[model samples]
Target: MKVLVVEDSDRLRRSLGDGLTKSGFSVDLAADGHEALAFIRTYDYDVVVLDLMLPGQSGLEVLRQARDEGRDLHVLVLSARDQVADRIRGLEMGADDYLIKPFDFGELVARLRALVRRRYACKNPRLRVGRVEVDTAARCALRDGEPVHLTPGEYAVLELLVRRSGTVLSQDQILDSLHGGEYAVSSNVVQVLISSLR
Candidate 1:
């Protein structure tokens, strides 16, 4: 999975980036809302971890613009404000989930996983398609009740397919979902991953 962590606090941003990287996500960091908007415009992220208080532009503004432009990326708002009204407003502004600051890292990861599953219209964390089962939280796949080892690229492609199971995803969309602007990917890489999965 790829995620964007948008926070004004340098320390918290770095901590979340490192922890999320270790937890198996490609992460991008933005100090404030403007930087985040730039990333959002240029790349495709599975989710955005946005902080409400920001310089240049506020997080809510970022969320609003992204939604207005029809960007369907999942957004999880992180704010120090824990008030009920604030939470409601964030959700109303198109945030998939809201997390207060000083939250447990584990909880954040868990919530992100849930959002990813939701994006795929997967109500169950353990997704089963035919005899293939994928544990989204564990980042592992099982085939015929036996574990199937998958390279990161292959797993990423599979995840994307599972997320949009009933639809046909062109190669460009698969590439977008796999890597952001920071990393260069060959056009045929998506095909390679799909062939490998087959």
Candidate 2:
């Protein structure tokens, strides 16, 4: 899944970006609310890891603006605010989940995965489509009981297709979700990736 990490702390942002990337997520980092808003508006991210305290605009304002646009964006507020009222306000403002700082990396990754699954309305971690079985939790795919070794990009495309099984996704959709808006590539790149998967 693609995620935008909106944290102002340099160390924390880098750490989260590195950790999330290693955890099999396409990650983009934004240091403040304006950058975060730009990233969120320009990219098709599955989730945004937001920090409430930010320069210029606060994370709450970002969340509010994103919600105001009526986009079904999954946001997980990662803040130092631990009070019940803080959490409730975040949820009320449109955060799908909340995680306090100094938290476990595993739990954060798990929560992000859960959000992606929820977005697709996929209850099971393992998705089976005909002869191919994708173990989303394990981040692996099996065909006829044999493991299929797929590159990260290949796996990402495969998972996207599998998650939206019945829906027809255009190449542009795949490109936007996987590469975001800044990475420029040939129009046929997605097609080549799909062909490789086949």
Candidate 3:
């Protein structure tokens, strides 16, 4: 999974990115809200780690803007503000989860995993399609009780498709899900991955 970390604190940013990367998530860092907005517009991210205070724009503004644009990005607000009102405000602004500073790295990972799991239920944990089963948490696939091997990219594409199973996900949508705030690859790439799934 890919995550965007929007934080102004250089130390915390690197620490979060490094920790998350170690946990098997692709991480992107944005120094402030402006950068965060630009990244969000250009790429797709499964979750956003946003700080309430920022240099250019406040995290609340960024979150509100994204929602207003009809982007369904899952946001987890990380800030030093720990008051009940602050938490309430962030939630009201559409943050999926909120965490205060000086938090346990383990807790951060756990909360992030939970948020992603809840947002993309079929993608984060496991997906079942007919007799085929894909275990995302384990990064494995099974067909009719037999194990199936899949390359990383192929597995990512299949996971994206199965996650939204009744929906006819366009090539761009699939790419967005897999890349997450990264550059969009060719639609033909998705076709190639789909062929591999067969």
Best model number under TM-score:
3
Per residue, candidate 1 scores C-alpha lDDT tens digits across 10-77 of 99999999899788777889998889999999877889999999998999999999999999789999
Q: How close to the true structure is residue 123 of candidate 2, measured as C-alpha lDDT?
A: 58
Top of the candidates by lDDT: 2
| Candidate number with the higher lDDT (2 or 3) | 2
Q: For residue 86, give model 1's deviation from the true position in Å.
A: 1.1
Task: Give the lDDT ranking, best first.
Answer: 2, 1, 3
Q: Which clashing pairs does model 3 show?
A: 44-180, 44-181
> If both were scored by TM-score, which would come out higher, candidate 1 or candidate 2?
2
Model 3, span 1-198: residue lDDT tens: 889999999998999898897887878899988899999997778899999999989999999999999997989999999999999999999999999987999999999888888876744476798988898778888999898988877788877777768888777766655643333545477778788898
Worst 10 residues of 1 by lDDT: 178-187
RMSD of each: 5.0, 4.7, 4.6
Global lDDT scores for all candidate models? 0.86, 0.87, 0.85
Q: Residues 69-112, candidate 2, lDDT per residue (tens digit)?
A: 88679999999999999999999999999999889999999999
Ranked by TM-score, the better of candidates 1 and 3 is: 3
Worst lDDT 10-window in candidate 2: 176-185
TM-score of each: 0.69, 0.72, 0.73
Q: Which residue pairs of candidate 2 clash? A: none
Worst lDDT run of 10 residues, candidate 3, spans: 178-187
